[model samples]
Structure formats: structure tokens, C-alpha cells
Target: MTQTIAIDNSQKLQLAPLDIPNRLLLGPGPSNAHPAVLEAMNTPPVGHLDPAFLGLMDEIQSLLRYTWQTQNQLTIAVSGTGTAAMEATIANSVEPGDVVLIGVAGYFGNRLVDMAGRYGADVRTITKPWGQVFSLSELRTALETHRPAILALVHAETSTGARQPIDGVGDLCREFGCLLLLDTVTSLGGVPIFLDTWGVDLAYSCSQKGLGCPPGASPFTMSQRAVEKLQQRKTKVANWYLDMNLLGKYWGSDRIYHHTAPINLYYALREALRLLAQEGIENSWQRHQKNVEYLWAGLEDIGLKLHVQQEFRLPTLTTVCIPDGVDGKAIAKILLNDYNIEVGGGLGELAGKVWRVGLMGFNSRTESVDRLLEVLPQVLSK
Candidate 1:
């Protein structure tokens, strides 16, 4: 059932087949997807509400719970990128004029401030320099001063390449009678995240970073307390598209239609989560750490300095300071054009001063690390 269009004789159309280069993705996100994941995406599309699709939906939720290490009944994948889930978290829980305190150590933390403000939250912030994270005592002091209704933090700050410690932040939020929300966009499958144990009331992550899938669907979860907050909201959620109250019904037993779910992306995510489960989550974390150690040592041997301290550095992403008299953008360009390797440049305050390298999910391997170290020297010399 293809339709033919009439075109004028003077009109010239340029159309061709699409082709992309084979690249080693060592960037901040959208890492190299697994072979199985790609194949899964090619499966024939099914109606979003079909019985077979509904069964797959159930399985996806189950695997997401396992991947996130939580028993939250509200765990499901949103139909957009990581930022969509972030908005859902804020929109649902933050009514008009609610005080929200956000920790700003990097770009994504700054993003929380903007998103919450759009939802009519009275946003307050405590900030440190780009490569540093706040201490539990500092957080406690902020809570005592502002006493916000919500306290949000980024678990792994992708822009600065720092992993914020969450061992006691959740307990402190509880003591202060505040709900905890976390952004795990770069840490979900690459690191250890215990939503229930860490008392994370709400959390969200992307598919492309640690899940080894294309960037489309996002993982989201809410604790019972967060659900209760939603239940008691005085005002309607500002954003209609990202309202979790409606999303919950669509993902829950009601099976009500909110929107057309991204069926193929969900298929890919299911396979990727299956791969993680097969490898064992703990094993995956250790693998990322080991690979990052190799990369760090290699970078140092080649006279490059890491931007963040070793203890707080994120294993999934690393920020390397640009050497004196070297062009950071040139390095990334040459790597892509000449070596067919892709890496990320700095962001926000660290722009032009550092390069962001990622070793996430399927891309975190000894061979990938060794390959980058092997060619980086040659590229730098020329």
C-alpha cells in the first residue's frame, strides 16, 4: 500500500541509502549496543496493548526491578529519555510552592533545579565545585536550614565524573521528613544501586548509558512514601505528557492507554536487561571497575591527568584534564575522523578543559580499553 507522489519536472530530489561508520563509542552515553539488543529491535512491531505485548511489558518491569535492586511496585519504563523520568519524579511529587532543596555539583544537578522550578517548587540549592561531592554533614546542615519538602541528588554526576556517596543521605532525608529523589542516569547498570536499602524514594535512569540499549526508554521507580505524596498533591501536575499518575495506570494493572509506548525500544531494553541478569549485576559492577582501572593507569602512563580524585571518580565515565599546549577538541575530532573512535568533550564549567571518556555496559571491556590506549598516543603525536 505505497502511495505515489507527483513531482514537477524542474524539481530535483536527492535521496540515497543511509550508512554509518563503525565506531568504538567511548563517549558519555549511547554506548555501543549489544548485538542481541540490536537484533531484538528488528523484531516485528506489535500493538502496544496486544496480549503478547502486555506479557512482554510485565517481564520488562520485573527485570527492571531486578536491575534496580528494588521491590517497588511502581517500577516501569517511561516512553522517553532519562530527563523525562526526572520530570515525572518532580511533577508528580512537587505541588505548587513546595520547598525543594537540590545538590548542585555538576550540570545534571543544575538541571534538577530548573525542572523543579518549572513545577512551581520553591527551589533551594547547595553547591560545590565541578569535581567535588557534598558530605553527609553538609547535607544535614542544608536540611536543617531550608527544611525542604524534597531533597534531590545525582548519584553519578556524568558531567563531572564523580560518584556521590549515598550510604547515609537517605537516612538523613527521613530524619528531616523529606522525600529523596536520585538521578542514576550514568550509574544504574554500571554501578551498585539499592533503591530500597538506600531509602531512595524516587529514582530514574536512561537506557543507552549502562543498559547497552539505544536512547529511548527510561527506567523509573517510586517508593511507597513517594506514591503517598502523589496521592496527597493539592495541585495538578503541570506537565501533562509526563504525569506519573496517568503513567502509573498505564503501567499498572489497569492497562489504561496513556500513549503509544515505544515497542521496539522496549524490546531492546528487555534484551539488554536480560544480558545484565545473565552476567550477574555484581559481576557487571566489578567488570566496569576493573576496566576503568586499566584506563586510568593507561591515561596516567601517557602523561594525562584525571580531573576527579580516585576515591570519588565514577567507573562508568572519566574526565581527563587537557594537557598544556594541546587542543582538546582537536583530540576528539582526530580520534573520530582518523581512528573511527568517538569520545565526549567537557561540559558546562569544565568545557574545553577536560575530555569525558565512558566505559559503560558492553563497552567496558579489556580489549576496548587497550584499543583506545593503543591508538591515543599516535593520534596525539600528529
Candidate 2:
């Protein structure tokens, strides 16, 4: 005879069904997933190893290659957000005592420095003032000085709305016999990128920012050079879960299990990539640029000044200077509370000095720009 377990009545719970405010996301990230992507996410989840799920995984890989314009065999989506992908890049590539050089001009740049150091890299950095980019000559000089095993740079500096030029940096890495890593979190789907042409050995990005998907899965890729470094590492990868050595088999032909994949988030990411491919990556880039430029014009019309040099501004995100005597937090708060619109405040060196406005992914539209402009002036007068 089996005894029935009593239902515990000690725990209090609210019986109300879930509800959340629907605000227009115009901030740094998660700028509104496309409706179709959300619909895909709502589909019932399948077993991680099911044949149908496996087929979808293959499609995601192929679509990622097309989106990044690289034929990297190891491209796969990590089960967490963009930070997981960033950690994966460092874990797979940095061996103990390897000298890793990073370019630091903003928050994400510093994040890479911290991550590389945590993985036992003897990290070195070449930094510029926030809102500036490194010149090829400066990078070459740093490469000569550090002589690191890996050189990492941020393609899109999200904190300061600056675009670091990648054209010749990869060539410098090749000449110095070092692997090139890049943080493309804010630029992947909405900005122009050619990983093969750029010679980036390792790169990672998120699904939320530029792919028009809800945050969860992240895109990561490694080239042959990085793979070779992994193969030659004398020490085991510091991060077991993110180690590409095991993940490769799971994502590759072997189909071995590593961890239980987040089935629904992958569904959303797959759909996001599908829509991006359908739109053509170049066209999507153009859309982000067009909308952001319109936003800039509107902001300037209202007596706002942008923080970054116009030439270095990112098309996906912009840093608008907060006018003198205006409380940046109050403005952002009023916009959210009254207008039901959201804008981001600064981070790191940019804090309290500027407003972080994003025109990324599905939210990069003329309507989005118009709506924000219409509501912003009303809030500012308060």
C-alpha cells in the first residue's frame, strides 16, 4: 500500500493570471521582438534530441552563416544571452598564461578584459577615451608592444555609440600571428559585417539586440585559426559548459548531448534569423541606418546634441547628449511612466551625461522614430 503525500498549504500564492505592461522598447537592447518571432517562441517545445528539433538546429546554423557572411563550420547558438557567448569565446580560446590584448573604449570592452583575465589570460589593453575608435596605426603599435596570443576588439561599442573600424585590424592580427576576437553584440544583424572578409577568428552576438528576437539564445562562431588554438591548448578550457570542444560535437554531425537546450528560445532565435534572411542582411542594415538617421535629425531639431562624433556613430544605437540642467533619470522616468515609451540611461563612463537610444531590429522603423520624437518633447518640458 502506498501513502498519498499531502498538498502543502503553507505556501501562499497569488492566483491572478500573468499580466505585464506593454511599453514601446526603444532602449539599448531587447528592442521589441518581431511578432512572428514571438509566435514561433510560443510553439510547443520539442525534446532537445528529437529529429525535428535537430533539423531546426541545422537550419539555425546555416542561417547564422548567411547572416554573418561566413562559412564557419562551428557557428552555433549558445543557450544563454550574449554574455554567455562572450564567455564562450574567451573560454575556448584563452589558455593559461596566454597574453590576451583587448581594445577598451567602453563598457563591453572592459567586460572582455575582465572575462579574458578570469580565464587565466595575462590580459593587456589599449584604450581610447570613451566615444572614440582606435586607429590602425595605434592598434599596430599596441600589437607590437603586447605581442599577445589574441587581440579582441568591440565592433560596436554600445555604451558610447561608437563604431570601431575593423577593416585593417584583422590584417594586423594575421601579420602578428595572433587570433582576432570581436564583440559584435550590437552590430550583428543591423550593421554591415563580413566575418570572412574581416578575418575575425572568433565573434559572438545576442539574439535580442539586432536580431529582433526576445533575449535568450546567442550566436557564436570560431574560424579555423581559433579552432587550431583550441586544439593546441595545453590546459583544459576553464568553462566546461561553454567549451567548444564538447559543444562542437553536439552541434555537429555527432549530435552528442552536452546540456539540455533551451528549446523555445532556440525557436525564437531560429525565426528571427529566418526573417533576417528573408529581409536580406544588407537591407536590414539599411533599415536600421535609415531609421536612426531620421531619429538624429529629429533630436537635433529639438535642440539635442549627440555625444559621439557623427562619423563614428552606430546606426543601431545613438548617444544623445542630455541638455544642461535636465535630469537624465527624470526624463527617462517620465517617458516611461507617462508616455509608455522607454529609453536607456548611460553606463560606465557615459552615465548621467547622455541618453542611450536604440533603433534596432524590429523597432528600427520610421513609426518608432516618429513616436519617440512626439512623446519626448512633451516629457522634457516637465
Candidate 3:
């Protein structure tokens, strides 16, 4: 049954039908979702705890394990964006007055320092210039000097398009008895991230970028050691909604009610992970690398300079130095308005000096790269 109310002309709302333009996403995140993923999102909703949904949850966890390349039992998708997962990891692991050391090189690294401090940790930061990554020795010295409980770093810094190398940093954490927390928001599926082999105790990422799903559900994992730290925490987690212990109960076998999970978003994530599995994680990594190389070559051919060096460049996102006398914002607007292509501008210290371009997940294709290359020069010239 339905009821309708008649309203005066003055009272009537001026709402119109919704219409969204089709734009190619070549920005830092929220990359174009796969067709199958979008279809899955449109599927009929189910109760979060329904039997069928629970089965789907199990499948998601299994697939997440495969994607993260870890056997950590606490691996699950947090109920919010990547930042929520970041908060969860920090709030659960850091107690009041605990010392935390962060390797800061870009915007997200600074974000980690802020989050850790808000959790009542004494934050110590060792920073390099935005486009440069910390060396292994620098990390070792920081850990030895700060003697913090956790050493956090960003695996792929989106702001500056720099990739931090973590080959031996984990061993240094072990020597100093510090837990290793990493932000993989841009690198998870697009790059090689072996959580266990790399000794990452805690890690978090988003679905929108590398997972090729809409933003909402975030991938999160914690090693057994991290779980032990949470179990032994003296104080209640600062944030209730992001409490890992409570979230673990809901995401784990207990299946207790925490909140109404974003049912459709989970559906989309499941399909996205399935697509990744079908393509093979290694193959996905190779695809991103190959596509980015092509993009770099094209940009170079057009006389554009990349901000990051070749050795430590991020494959998923690249920072193009804005040529002198060219307005970065204008170029981005022209591309969006005239070409229906979306790209990102710089953040923090790099603003107006560079443009952040991303080729992630579904957008990491030769065709998309070629289209951007074709329009980029025209946009810059204008």
C-alpha cells in the first residue's frame, strides 16, 4: 500500500531524475569498477547475518587471504574506508603513553603520525623529502633511537607516487621488538605485498583502488603477534566503532552483531576479488607494471617529467611534474569538462607542482593509458 500527498506549487520540490556522466577515472582512487562488480552491487540485498550472506562472508575471507598472501586468522574487511582500517590498527595496538615511530615521506605518512598520536601514543617521526623513500639504515636508526612499540610506514605513498622498500625493515622491527604496520591502500593488488614473508604485523587497504570496487569496505589483516598485543592491551580501544576486538567477533566465527554491514558493498568486493583471482594476482601485478611503463614512456615522449625516480616509483600511481607556466588545476578541469577524463592534483607540499595520475585495477589497461596520453598534451597546451 502507498499514500500520496498533493502539495501547492510553492511547496513542491524541484527534484529531477538522477543522471551521472560516464567518466574515465584516472585519479588516485575510486577507479572504475569492473562491470561484473557493478552488477553484483545491483543484486538484491540480503541480511548481513543471513545464512547465504554468511557463506559469502566465508568466501570473501578465503579470497582475501589469497589476495593478501597471508594466513593470518584475523584477516577481514573493515566496515568503512581505508582510513577506518588505519584507525582500527592504531587504536587497537597503541596504548596510552606508548612510543610509536612513523616513517613520514608524504601525506599518508603524516596521516599515520596523526592517527597514532590521537591514540595516545608518543609519536616519533623520521621524515624524508616527499618524493623520496627512507633508506633501510635510516629506518634502523629510527627504530633503535625511538624504541617505539610500533613502527609504521606507507607501502605506496599516493601523494608523491613513491614506493617505500620494506625488504629488511621488518627484521629490524623484530630486533627492536616493534610491530610493523603498513598502509597498502594503493598497492595491495597492484603491487607485490607478501604480508607474512615481509613480516608485516598489521596492514590495511581499500577496495576502490586496487580491488576495483567502490569505496566503503576496507581490507584489513593482523598477524598473530598483533592479535596478542591487542589481547594484552591495558586500556579500552579509544574508538568503539573501530575496536578490532569487537570487529573481530563480528567478522570472525562469533558473528555477533556490531552494526548492519554494508551488504551490497560486500557483494561488490566479493566479485572484485573473484575477478582478481581469475586473472591471477601475479598477472594483475604484471598488468599494472606493464601499463604504467607504457604510460611513463608516453609521458616522456611528450616531454613531461615524472616526480619520482625510476627505482622507487609506484606502479599504480604516478606524479607528473607540472611544467612551468602551466596551471595544473586548469589542465585537470579541461580534461574533465572536454574529455570526460578524471585525474588528481597534488596534495600538501606538492600542490600546484605536480599532477597525480593513477592506473589502477580496472583502469590499468593499455587503452585507458593511450586515451590519457592522447588527451594530456592537448589539455596541457590549452
Candidate 4:
């Protein structure tokens, strides 16, 4: 006979069920999930390996392919946040001692540098100011100097609201016999990206941003060129969970068991993707552009200066310059507490210098822009 141990109850406080406040998320990355996505997430979950769930998995892959405008058969969702998918791309492609060149213009770019270095790659970086983007000629010069095995870049720098132009980068990578890895975490559903056309070899994105879904499963895909590199790597991927060879078996026809999938998150992601497809990706891009322009006009009208140059500005997020003698964090807090509006303060080099405002996914609307513009002037006056 076994005696059960009594659990201590003194430290446990009785609390009400979670009641979250409602706020319009006008910040970087997550910009509020759609109501439909929330409802889909609430649906009862099914077994991860159930036939129905597997079918949903297939649908998700297809939708991701469409969303990314890539036909890579290995496209799949990683069972974690955007960072997990970001790590997956690095782990699968980089081998110890391989020269990896990364573009570092903002916070996330630095994140790639850290992740790549941890994976044992000899990392080289081409840097720019926080709100500036690289030129094609500069990338060509860097490729000539490093001649690296992989070239990684951030298509949209969330921290600085700068969009890196990648139209001719793929050809440059091919010319250098290197693979092109792109971070589309902030640009995926809202920005205009033709992955296959641009010849991007590997890319990753988050569910919560342009996808209009909550933070959980993330989109990841690799081109045949990148897959070949992975297949020929001398050593096994250092991270087992992110090892694509094994993950491929689970996502591919092998259907092998890997980790337990986030069923409800997948449900939400599917609904969000479906809605995006219905809206037509091109239309969504246009919508984001129009709304962001409206937001830019409104912000300028309120005498706020934007951080990024007009040519490099992103449609999804904008970095607003924080005027001298004004507190960016305090304004953000007041907007959250009083106005029920959420905007983000800057990160890294831009810290205390700018405020990050996002018009992404379901929040990219004239109404959202108007609301933020209405409160910003009042807050600044005080």
C-alpha cells in the first residue's frame, strides 16, 4: 500500500479566473488577433496525430506556402513562438566552422548574430544605423569580402520600422554560391513578398503579427537549395527539437511522431490563414499600405517625426521619434492604462529615442490610426 503525500496549501491564494483587459494593440509584432482567430482557438482540441488533425496540418502548410508565395514542399509550422522558428533556420543550416554573414540593422538582426554564433558558425556582419537599410551594392561588396556559406537578412526590421529591399539579393547569393536566409517575421502576411520569385532559400515568420493570430505556432520554410545544404551537413543539428531532418519526417509523408502539436493554436492559425486567403494577399498588402499612409499623415499632422527614411519605411510598423523632454515609456503606459491603447517603446539602439507603432494584421485600419492619433496629441500635451 502507498501513502499519498499531502500537498502544502498555505501558499496558494484563491483567485478569480483570468479576466484580461481589452486594449487596441498598436505595437510592434502582435497587433491584435482577429475575433475569428480567437473563436477558432477556443474550439476543443483534437489529438495531434488524429487523421483530422493531420489534415489540418496539411492545410496549414498549403496556406503558409500561399501566404509566403513559395512552393517549397517542406513548409511547416514550428510548435513555438517566432524565436523558435528563427532558431530553427539557424540550427538547420549552420555547421560548426561555416562562415555565416548576417545583416545587422536593428535589434532582431543582432538576435540572429547571437543565435548564429551560439550554433558555432563564424559570424560576420554588415551593419547600418538602426533605422537604415542596406543597399544592393553594399551586400555585393560584403559577399565578395566574406564569401560565406549563408547570407541572412531581416526583410522587415521590427525594432526600427525599416524594410530591407531583397529583390536582387537572391541573384547575388547565387552568384556567390551561398544560400539566402530571410527573416520575414514582421512582413509575412502584410508586406509584399514573392519568396520563390526573390529566390529566398529559407525564411521564418511569427503567427501573431501579420497573420492576425495569437503567438504560438510560427511559419517556417526552406527552399530545395537550403534543404540540400541541410541534408549534406557533416554533423547532426545541434538542437534536436529544431532539427529539420527529424521535423521533416513528422511533417512529410513519413508522419513520424515528433513533439505534441499545439492543436488549438493550429486551429486559430488555420482560420487566420483562411481569412487572409479570402482577402487575397495582394489586397491585404494594398490595405496595409493605404492604412499606414493614413497613419503617417495623421502622425505628421500631430507634429511627430518618423525615425526611418520614407523610402525604407515599412508598411506594418513605424518608428516615431520621441521629442526631447518627452517620456516615451510613460506615454505608452498612459495609453495602455487610460486609453486602452497599446504602443511599444523602442529597443536596443533606438531605446528612449522612439516609439514603435504598428498597423499590422487586423489592426491595420483607418479607425485604428484615427484612435491612436486622437490620443497621441492629448498625451503629449500633458
Stretches > 4 Å off in candidate 3? 1-13
lDDT of 2 at 334: 89
User: What does candidate 1's lDDT look like per residue over 226-253, in tens digits?
Assistant: 9999888777778888888898888889
lDDT tens per residue, model 2, 147-201: 9999999999989999998998888999999999999999999999999999999
TM-score of 4: 0.99
lDDT head-to-head 3 vs 4, winner = 4
Q: Per lDDT, what order, best first?
A: 4, 2, 1, 3
Model 4 has a clash total of 0
Query: C-alpha displacement of 154 in model 1, angstroms?
Result: 0.6
lDDT of 2: 0.94
Report, for all candidates in order, the number of backbone clashes. Answer: 0, 0, 0, 0
Displacement of the residue 121 alpha carbon in candidate 1, Å: 0.7
Candidate 1 — which residues are off by over 4 angstroms?
Answer: 1-13
The root-mean-square deviation over C-alpha atoms between each candidate and the true structure, in angstroms, is: 2.3, 1.5, 2.5, 0.9
> How do the residues 63-99 of candidate 4 rate in per-residue lDDT, one tens digit apiece?
9999999999999999999999999999999999999
* Whole-model lDDT values for every prediction: 0.93, 0.94, 0.92, 0.95
The alpha-carbon deviation from the true structure for residue 33 of candidate 4, after best TM-score superposition, in angstroms, is 0.8
Q: What is the lDDT of residue 127 in candidate 4?
A: 99
